[model samples]
Target: MRIIRLSVGLLMLAMVGTGCISKKKYDALSKDHETLRASSASANSNLQTCQQNLAAATTRVSSLEEQIAQGKAAITALQASLEKCLSGANQGNVNISKLVDEITASNKYIQHLVNTKNKSDSLNMVLTNNLTRSLSREELSGVDVQVLKGVVYVSLADNMLYKSGSYEISDKAGATLAKIAKIIMDYKDYDVLIEGNTDNVPISKPNIRNNWDLSTLRASSVVQALQNQYGVDPKRLTAGGRGEYNPVADNNTEDGKNKNRRTQIIITPKLDQFMELIGQAPKTDGTTPQQ
Candidate 1:
């Protein structure tokens, strides 16, 4: 009996020891699982960052490629221009270095001219917009404003400006003329040329001998009105005539004849300033080109 009791006690102690060992092993396994899960999360984060960096790099590369393509196209155009210039140069005993220098200077001068043209175009566009905006719909009914080759042209129908077959300004056209005068006064640097045009129809008025005389008188009337009544500078005003010679359309039809009989107010930048800009061409050797 005593031996049996001792055996039972040893059995119970062994079972308790086995249970403690199993609990310790379960705790260790749980810790290892958590460590593996944290490692996987860190790796995923690193992968996402790398992907973002790659995308940014791709965008930068695309921008650089486009810039390179534009540069190549510009180089090709410049090469073509240079080749054409060389072909036109004197071929016999040509000084290669001096010719290259001259070509460079010519290129610079061409660029200068292009810049000047762009500036003049901008000015003309501004002037046209300002005039169009300031004039009311009724005032602009028989008027056409346009910018052509860096010049502003305001074409007014003869019926709108003068009495039929006469050089006298009509009473109803006063308001429109006043608005135009204000615009002209605003652009103090620009000069105004009032040009009169006529159809091919012969005129036998008391004072008017022919179309030429009528056209010139019509232009003079507008010029005088602008200076005398509207307070426009006399020095900036010029009067001219184009009688049946510079027709805008065929004079055979009535509509065409009506279109041809019109007055044009040509606005241009001062010639002195423009001539000065042209005279100041750039030299290849960092000097100014001779006038």
Candidate 2:
């Protein structure tokens, strides 16, 4: 028995020395090594994916920040431009409004001027037509009716009103004078001026010294006749003499001298409205005058 045990121990030693292992243990070890290798490969793959994802995320974040900065800059530029445009538009509107106001005021003033002129012309036409129709054919023959500068001038020949070198009005002239007084009464708002024109011949009468005095006396006589005899308003009458200075013809000729001897009754409408409008004209400093 001792010899058999010795042999068995020697055999086992020899097998261990030869590196012989059991089949079940070797299989188990191989399986455990395969599982550990799979686990390690999976961990390496996950780490590589995580690093790639981090790099991609960092690049995306940089792109987003750059885009955000650009957007902010664009917004600021747009805001400034909008403000500038608004300011310019506001100023332009103010200028346009002021210009419109000035144009309106100017148009109003010009319209008033036109209205005043039209009114004066209408009055002149009315007076001329009425006076022409009221005077007789015989009376019109010795008179010239016309309107000059808003005044109705009725010029009567000296032969129709007086004789040579005389200041007395004739009895025939009384009818003509009465017609003029009727016109004066009809247009009570008008102002009447009696003007006497004389020839260049010198006068040496008791009450007259020269043509000026003769003309003056003639105008005064007509004014007195209209006021006292015809009931004309004294305030509406104004007498003046033009003598030979304002002659219609040459003083050297007999026909011209006869033409020069005349009496002019000037009737002018009142200018109250025209004067008031003129007073309300706009001032030079781009402002209206205070009422």
Candidate 3:
């Protein structure tokens, strides 16, 4: 009986010890599970925050790209405006300079005309008064001719040159042209200007139309005769048409209107500086052909 009781007590003690070990194992397993859950939650939270921040950053980057595009467009427009302004400013500058130069040139011309008027008047009178005494010819019968302001003026009337309005040079007028050409060719000092003038007589035809046409044709005819027949070099000649713009006499009077319908040959001397400059050339021996 004593041995049986001892065996029973040892068995009881073994059962209690096993129960304590099982409870300790259960507590450790529960703690390990909680730790794993906490770590997983923290990792998931961090990943979600990073995604949200990345989305915000991406949106900001996209907005910046749009702003950059707009800025570039604005810059392009500004550049175009600047270029236009520059071009306009440059044109204005050039025009102002040209106007200044023209003003200066006109002043010089006016001064020169004022100073030479008296001496030129004395020489010009000998050639102007009494056309019969100075120039005599049948072709110049009704044609009025005079020398004024250093130019020869040939005024045509209906009785002279042609039947009504024609560009034909008359038979006797050939001698007059020859005489004029001889005088001009004789002196190599002057440059000549042949200007054709016309009356206010309106004309319209297949061959001729208006004063401009008549004047141009007459001028051309005179130029051709001078160059071909008179042996005048073309380089030394220039012809122009006034077309009733410049008139020496009243147009209401028949005789005065006749004087307005005219041609003129103006002779002029080049400035001395031009000749001096040309003479400075080493290849030329101070002699240049006037033509």
Candidate 4:
């Protein structure tokens, strides 16, 4: 029995003695596993950074697109405005571009006759008010002939003719009227509006009563001169009279009153293009003009 126990103990001792493992090989395997885990962590961090950069780049691209859209819109608006302006000027010598560009939605405004307005701006700058035989007192008075707000405000005074109550465009006024007539004849293709006005003084004549009648007659007479004498286009001509209502200055002063009583010959160019810019159609002859 002792011999059998001794044999079993010997066998256990030999198994324990032979159970040897290499420390260097186990440590190498452990190091390889740690390196693999670190590499995986680094790769994940790089992927997160790449996603963040992509998001930032997308935002920048979107901003640039917005700016491009705004610029296109601005360019479109300006082009439309410029086209409309040119059209209005082409219609008449009385261009009111400044008025159109300047006047706001606020109520302060003057009357705008549609047919007359379209014709007021377009001109070739012909007959630069030089000859003594055909110019108004204002034109001869070192006047600067320039367009303002698109209206060719012809500055003239009634003192060139008439003795405060007369409608006869005096013999002295002939030289001035002749030059103007020549200009009108030269631009026969244009439209014309002869407007007459009078001071605040009450005018009650046997034939002409009130300032309205006097103003109307004066305007009519001017129209007749243009149409009959110079052979201006009657279709392009119109006469309107404003007694004391359409004053440009204070009637309390003599100079102011004179300024208000003067006549205006408005010349207009073609207006088809101008009307289109404003989303309207140019009024052809035989149709009632805008007022």
Candidate 5:
């Protein structure tokens, strides 16, 4: 009986030990399931946050692409407008340059005309004054001293120059020619033309064949006297004869014939200086032509 009691005690002890071990293992399993549940909930939260962030990023990308396309279109339009503006500006510059050239040319032409007129008027005034001052009142009345077309014409009666039907210059004419030479010598830039005119009455004499010969000889004689007798320059003198033609009055009347037989001395200014000024080109600095 003692052996059976000890074996039964041992069996009870083994049963109690197994029950405690089973309880401990069950507690550990419960704790491990709770930890796994917490981890799964945290993971699901993280995935939802990631999906929302992806949606925001996609919206921002679409907006940025639309803005880029609009910017490109605006840039293209601006380039086209710039090109058009440049083209218009270039054309306007060309037109302005052409207008400036035309205005400059017109101004040059007008200035040339004004300068020429001024020079002519000034020369004519000087010639008229000098000729009028050189002669006496009685001499001026007998001879016509007039300025026509910038030239001085002195018309003297035939009685002042020569005798009837004679080609020789008289003493009175020589004195008059010497007075004229004084005025002529003062101005070297003048050209002198001595013209002799005669009536239609025919004449035949020694050393004179016809009225033409008489008139020609008279003009030559006056020219020679002006050069040799006075100090007049031979280079500036010219002799001309108009016989029976270009008469101032009718040759039929004696008084008219006498009036027709006259001598004309024409004095003209040289045009070399004026012509040289007109021939020059316009200045590059936009100034007037040189005087």
Candidate 6:
């Protein structure tokens, strides 16, 4: 009976020890499960971060591609424009050279015209001075020598050239006409115009009809005297008349009437010479005119 009681006590102690071992194993299993749960949560967080990084990388790659495409398009356009410019370079250079040549030719022609005008003005001034110096002071009283628009005008008063109310030249006019004729002959290239002017006073005579007839007859008589008596070239002489017209002053006063009734000898370069000068202008291609 004592052997039997000792075996039973040993069996109870073994059962208590088995319960303690079971409790310790349960606590260790719980701790391992919590550790596994924490590891799973950390792995999930790392996966999400990687996904976000990949998305950003993809977006950046797409932007780079778009920028590269735009750069290529701009480069292509610039290359095309450069090629076009190179192809037309020769023609553009030629056009520019031609324009420059035309401008140069125009400037030269303008200078030529200015030079001709200066020479003409100088000649007119010299001619006027010579006439003024040749005439005596008393002769200069009734004669007015002037240079107007490159032409010489010698105005002679009616009392100095002709008798009162007559178209015939007076005997005193011979010396003055001779001096004028000598000047006209000296300028062989110049043409002479004898212009007669008359006052508004009406005249009645068997030979003279009106102021028109008187003025015309006076101009024609002067022209003939310069040709036949003074030996001036007839081809260079022209006759014209202004009846009660071309007045220098008011016709209401006697002095004005006297001034209105006068003869003018106009001397000018020949028309053919002027035409020749115009024809001698430079060509548009910058070539000089033929001599």
Question: For this target, which candidate reaches the highest TM-score against the unseen true structure?
Answer: 6
TM-scores of all candidate predictions against the true structure: 0.63, 0.65, 0.45, 0.48, 0.60, 0.81
Q: For each candidate, what is the lDDT?
A: 0.86, 0.84, 0.67, 0.64, 0.78, 0.86
| Residue 52 miss distance in model 3 (angstroms) | 99
Across 12-80, the per-residue lDDT of candidate 2 in tens digits comes to: 556557868665755665575556567767877898899999999999999999999999999999999
Q: Considering only N, C-alpha and C atoms within 3 Å, which residue pairs clash in candidate 6?
A: none
Clashing pairs in 2: none
lDDT of 1 by residue, 211-263 (tens): 99988899999999999999999999999998888899999999999999999
Query: Model 3, 1-291: lDDT tens per residue?
Result: 344445545654565567754656556645755565677678778989999999999999999999999999999999999999999999999988877766665555545555454545554554444333445666456556666556555554533443357777766567677766776675455566778887787867679878898877777777888899999877777888888888878888887778788777665554563465444332222222222
Give the Å error, residue 197, model 2. 0.8
* Candidate 3 minimal-lDDT segment of 10 residues: 282-291
Clashes of each: 0, 0, 0, 31, 0, 0
- What's model 2's TM-score? 0.65
Full-model lDDT, candidate 3:
0.67
Count backbone overlaps in model 3: 0
Candidate closer to the true structure by lDDT (higher is better), 3 or 5: 5
Q: lDDT of candidate 1 vs native?
A: 0.86
Single out the weakest 10-residue window by summed lDDT for candidate 2: 1-10
Between candidates 3 and 6, which one is better according to lDDT? 6
Which is the winner by TM-score between candidate 2 and candidate 5? 2
Error of 4 at 276 (Å): 6.3
